[model samples]
Target: MWKALRITTLLFVLLGVALSAWRNERNATDWIGPLVVAVYPINADGSELAERYLQALAVERFEPVSAFIAAQGMRWQLPRTVPVDFRLAPRVNALPPPLPRDGNVLSVINWSLRLRWWAWRHDTYAGHWKQVRLFLLYHDPARSPQLAHSTGLQKGLLGVVNLFASPDMNAQNNVVLAHELLHTVGATDKYDPSSGQPLHPDGYAEPAREPRYPQRYAEIMAGRVPVGPDEAEQAASLQQTVIGAKTAREIGWLR
Candidate 1:
C-alpha cells in the first residue's frame, strides 16, 4: 500500500509539472507573430541617419516601449520570432527578401512609388495574410506637396513623413517607427498634428516625459508616471490582459 501511494504521489507531481510547462508556453505564444522590419537600400552616400534608423529598428524588436499599447487587449500579431533586416540596395524592389510564407507582412518602404508598387505586387500573393498593410513615407522632403497629397491614397495603405531627409534622426525614427507599426493592426496615433492633443482617451500627455502606472514615459504610449526606468515591469503588469487568447484574437495576433 505504501509503495502504491508513493507511485501515485510521484505521478501527480509529474503531471503538475507538465501542466505548468504547458501553461507557460501557451502564454508566451499568445503574442502576435514576430515583427519583421525590412530596411530599404540606402541610395545617398554616407547617410548616417539611415544607418542609425536601422539600428533603432533592431532595438525596438525586443525592447518593451508601452505596455498599454502592447496590452491594449489586442492579441499582438507578433511572430514566433521577430526579425529586422537592413539591406544595402539603391531601391526597394532590388532587395531580395523571402516573401512571408504565411501571415501578415508589415512593409515600411522609404523609396520611390514605382519601386514601392513593385514590392507591393511581389509581396502580396494569394493566402499571405488575413490582411496586408503597406505604409510608405515620403522619400523626398522637397516634394512635400505631392507626398502630402499621397498620404491616404491606397486602401489598406498609409503614408507618413518619409524622414529620409529629416535632419533630426532620433525624432524622425521614433515617430515613424512607432506610427507605422501601430497602424498594421488598427492602432491610431494618439497625437493630433494640429493641436498636438492625444487622440485616444488615455490621459498620457507626453509619453516621452511621463512614466505612470499602466503607462510609462512622457510619450504616453509607454511612460512611467514617475518618469523612471522599469519598462519591463510596467509591461508585465499589463500582460494579464495583453497576451491572453481573447486579446490576441481581437488584434488578429491569433487566427
Candidate 2:
C-alpha cells in the first residue's frame, strides 16, 4: 500500500509539471507582451577571473539581446514593440547537469528532465513573471577558448548557453544567447549541421539580393554570414544579424 501511494504521488507531480510546461510553450510565441527571460550566470570554470566577472555583472550587459528582439519585432510589424524583457538573476552557485556525451535519445531525454528540475530549484528572479529561463555558463576564455555547444528546449522554456567571461566577448556572447533564447520559443536552426552553412533562400537574410555571393547580414537562426558559396563567418554581434521571415513565422511574429 505504501509503495503504491508513493508511485501515485510521483505521477501526479510529474503530470502537473508537464501541464505547466505545455501552457508556457503555447504562450511563448504569442507576441502579445514582452516575454521575460531571466538570465542566470554561472561560474563554469571556477576561476578567480570568472568569479570577478560575475560580481560586476549587470542587466545592461545583456541589453543588446533585448534590443535586437525589439528591433526584429518592429520589422515584423508585431503588436508588441518590446518582444523580450531580459532580467539578470542572481548568480547560481551550483553547476547544472552535464549533457549526454553519446547523443542517445533516451540519455538526452533523461538529461532534459534533470535540467528542468534543477532549474526550478535555482531560479531566484522576482521582478517579473519569468517566461523563459536561460542559464549562462561563463568560462575563462584563456583557459577554454572553445566552449561546448549550447542547448535550448522549447517544451521546458529553458536554455543552457556556454559563454566566455570577458568584456570583449560581450557582443559575441549576446549573439549566441539570442540564438539560444529563440530556440526556447520554437525557433529551429537554419544551418546545415554537417557543413555549418546557412541553407539558401530560407536561411539567407537577403536571398533575393542581386549579387548575393556576400551577404551583408546573417539570418539570426542561420547563425553565420554567408560570404561565399563555400564559406561562412559568425556574426560579430546581434547588430550584424536579422530574423529571417521563416524564423519570424516560427516564433509567431507573423501569421
Candidate 3:
C-alpha cells in the first residue's frame, strides 16, 4: 500500500507540474501588463563577503534590468514598454539542493518538485505580487568562487542565480539575471552548453554583421559576445547585451 501511495503521489506531482508549465506558458505569452518580478537574496555562505553583498543590496541595483527590457521593447516597436517591476525580498537562510545534472525524465520531475515546493513555501512573502519571481543565491567567491552557477526554468516563473557576492560582480550578475528572466517567460538558451559558446544566427545579436567573427554585442539569451568562431566573453553589463529577434519572439515581445 505504501508503494502504491508513493507512486500515486509522484504521478500527481508530475501532473501538477505539467499543468503549471502549460498555464504559465500561456500566461507569459499573452501577458499584457507590467510583470512584477520579485528578487529574493540567499546568502549561500554565511561569510563576511555575503554580509557585504547584503549590505550593498538596494532596489536601484535592479534598475538597469528594467531599463534594459524597456529599451528592448522600444527596439521591437512594441506598443508599450515591457514593464518589469523588481523588488527585493528579505534574505532566506537556505536554498533547496541543486537540480540533478542528469537529463532524464525522472530527474526533471524531481527538480520540478523541488522548485515548486521552494516557490510555494516562499510565495507568502510575495504578498499578491502575481507575476514572475526570481531568487538570487549569492555566494562568497573567496570561500568557493569556483562553485557558482545560475539557472532558470522555462515557463516556471522562478529562477535561481548563483554568483559571487560583490559590487564588482554586479554587472555580470545582472546579465545572468536578465538571461534567466527571459527563460521564465519562455526564452530558450541559445548557447552550446558543452562549450559555453553562443550558437549561430539564433544566438548572435547581429547575425548579419559584415564580419561575424567579432560581434559587437551579446544576445541577452546567448549571454556572451562571440569574439571568434570558438571564443566568447561575458557582456560587461546589460548595455553590452540585447534581446535578439529570436529571443524577442520566444518571450512574446513579437509575434
Candidate 4:
C-alpha cells in the first residue's frame, strides 16, 4: 500500500506541474494582458569585463525588446497595447545547470527538469507566478566572441539566453533575446539549422516582394534576412525584424 501511495503521489505532482505550465502558456499568448518576463543576468565567464558590464546594466537596455513586442502587438491589433514586459532581476551568482552536449532525448528531458527546479529556487522576482523566466549569460566579446545557441522551453515557460556584454551589442543582444523569448510562448524557428539560413516563404518578412532574393527585413523567428538565394545575414536589431504571419499564428497573435 505504501509503494502504491508513493507512486500516486508522484503522479499527482507531475500532473500539477503540467497543468500549471499549460495555464502559463495560455495566459502569455492570449493577447489579453501584458506578459511579464523576468530576465536574470549572469557572468558567463568569470571575467572582469563581464562583471563590469553587469554592474552598469540597467532595465533601460531592455526597453527595445518591450517596445518591439508592443509595436508588433499594435500591428496585429492585440487586445492590449503591450504584449510583453521584460523586467530585469537581481544578478544570479550561481550558474544554471549545464546543458547536455549529446542529443539523447532522455538527457534533454532530465536537464529540463533540473533547470525548472533550479529556476524555482532562484526566482528573485516577487510576482503572481505568471512571469516567464529568462536566464541571460553574458560573455565578454573579447573573451568569447561566439556564444552557444540559446534554448527556450515552452513546457516550463523559461529560457536560457547567451549574449555578449558590451554597450554596442545591446541592440544585437536584444534581438537574440527576443527570439528566444518568443520560443517560450510556442514560436518555432523558421530557419534551417544546418545552413543557418532563413527558409522560404515562412521565414521571409516580405515574401511577396517583386524580387525575393534581396529581402529587406528578417522574420523574427528566422533570424536572418535573405540577401541572396544562398546567403543570409543576421538582423542588427529588432527594427530590421518583423513578426511574420506564421509566427504570429504560432504565438496566438493571429487566429
Candidate 5:
C-alpha cells in the first residue's frame, strides 16, 4: 500500500511539472506580436482581380504548411477577424509605421513594396517580420512596372507572390511570395542562379523550370503559394522555422 501511494505521489509531481511548463510556454507565446496586413489600391480591373486572388488563397489548401508547423510544435495564426484592408492613395506617403516593437506589418501588392522602401530608406526595417514584411500580388512579371527595381532597403533577393499572373506566371508568383517571406525570416533558397549561384538563395526560377526544383515545387516557400495538400507539410515546416526564428529574435532567443 505504501509503495503504491509513493508511486502515485511521484506521478502527481511529474504531472504538475508538465502542466507548469505548458502554462509558461503558453504565456511566452501570448507575448509575441500580432501580424498586421495592409493592401494598396488596385485599378478597378486589378482590384477585382486582386479580390479573386485573395479568395483563391483563402480557399486553397494550407494543410502542407500547417502540418509542417505542427510537426515542429510551433504556434501561429493568420488574422481571422479582419479581411485585410486596402488603403486609398494620394495624400499620405507610401510608408508603414515603425515596427510595433512586438508586431509586424505585411503589405500586399505594390503598397507593400512601397512601404518596404520607406522603411528601408529610413533604416527602420530590421528584416521582414522582425522589422516588416511585404507581400505583393500582380498579374504580369515582365510588363509590371510596379515591381520596379528594389532600393537598398529590400534585397529583392526573394519575391513574394499573388494569384493574378497568367496561369504559368501565377505558379511562379506563388512560389516567389512564399520564398521571399521566408527570406525575411531567414530561409535561403536552394535553387541555382545563372551567375554561378548554386542555389538562387531567393529560389525563383523561370516559369519553364518550375518542375526541376522539386523542393520549391513541393515545398511551401516555392510552389505552395496557395497552400495545397501535398504542400501542407512543407508549409508547416516553413512556419516552424520562420516563427521560431522570429520569436527567438524578438525575445532575444539568439542572444
Candidate 6:
C-alpha cells in the first residue's frame, strides 16, 4: 500500500509539473520577476581536480547568463529584465545514474525517479523547492578523458550539466550551462541530434543575412557557428552567441 501511494504521489507531482510547464510556455509575455536558479556541483569522478574545481566555483562565474538574458530581453522590449539569479550551492558526493539514451517514456520516468532519489538523498531541493535547481556534474579530464553528455527537463525545475574541470573549458562550459538553463524554461534544442549541427534558419543566428555561409555568431539554442553548408564549429564563448528570434519567442523573451 505504501509503495502504491508513493507511485501515485509521484505521478501527481509529475502531472502538476507538466501542466505548469505547459502554461509557462504558452504565457510568453508574463514576467514573474527574477527566477532564482541554484547550481549544485557534483564531483563525478571523485578526482582531486574535480574537488578543486568545485572549491573554486563562484556565483560570478554564471553572471554572464544573467547578462545574456538581460541583453535579449532589452531587444524584445520586455517590461523588465528577465533576470536569472544563480546561486552556487553545496556539492553532492554521488552522481545520478545515466539517463537512458533511447528516450522512451518509461525509461524517462525511471530516470527521473532515480534522479529524484539522488537529489532527495543529498537534500538538493530541501530549502529551494520553489526555485529552479541545476545539478552540474564535473568530470576531471585527467581522470576521465571522455566527455560527459548533459540533460535538462522542462517538467522538473532541474538539469544536469556534465562538463570538464578546467579553467580553459569555462567559456564552453557556460555555453552548455546556458543552453541547458533554457531547456528547463521550455526552450527546445534547435540543433540536429543526428549530425549535431544547427538546423537552417531557426538555428541560424543571422538566418536572413546575405551570403549566410559564414555566421559571425551562434544561436544559443543551436550552440554552433555555421561556417558552410555542411560544416560548423562550436562557439568559443557565450560572447559569440545570441538568443535568436525563434528562441527568444520560445523562452518568452519575445512576443
lDDT of each: 0.36, 0.91, 0.83, 0.90, 0.35, 0.81
- TM-score for all predictions? 0.36, 0.93, 0.87, 0.94, 0.33, 0.86
Per-candidate alpha-carbon RMSD to the true structure: 17.0, 1.9, 3.7, 1.6, 17.2, 3.7
Query: Best-fitting candidate, measured by TM-score?
Result: 4
Off by over 4 Å in 2: 1-14
Backbone clashes in model 2, listed as residue pairs = none
Candidate 4 deviant stretches above 4 angstroms: 1-10
lDDT for each residue of candidate 2 in 1-255, tens digit (9 for 90 to 100): 999999999999989988887888888877777898899999998998899999999999988898999898889898787888888998898989999999999999999989988998988777658899999999999999999999989978999999999999999998999999999998999999999999998889999998998999999889999999979999999999999999998888888
Which rank order by TM-score, best down to worst? 4, 2, 3, 6, 1, 5
For model 3, what is the error of residue 49's alpha carbon versus the real structure, in angstroms, after optimal superposition?
1.5
Which is the better candidate, 1 or 2, if ranked by lDDT? 2
Candidate 3: lDDT of 100? 78
lDDT of 4 by residue, 1-255 (tens): 999999999999989988877887888888677888899999999899899999999888889999998888888787787788778889888889989999699999999999999998988776554568999999989988888879988888899999998988998998999999999999999999899899989999998998787999999999899999899999999999999999999999899
Clashes of each: 34, 0, 0, 0, 17, 0
**Best-first order by lDDT:** 2, 4, 3, 6, 1, 5
Per-residue alpha-carbon lDDT of model 1 for 1-255, expressed as tens digits?
A: 999999999999989967764553343334444433332332232345444444344323324323334433333445433322211212333332322333343432323344435556544223332222333332333433232211221223322324354433334333444444444433333444454443333324332333333433333232112222222221122222122233234335557
User: lDDT score, residue 28, model 3?
Assistant: 61
Candidate 6 structure quality by residue, lDDT tens digits, 121-236: 77553454335678988988877677767887765556888988998888888899999888877788889989988998999999988998898999989999999987889998
Clashing pairs in 4: none
Choose 3 or 4, whichever is better by lDDT: 4
Model 4, TM vs. native: 0.94
Q: Is candidate 3 or candidate 5 better by TM-score?
A: 3
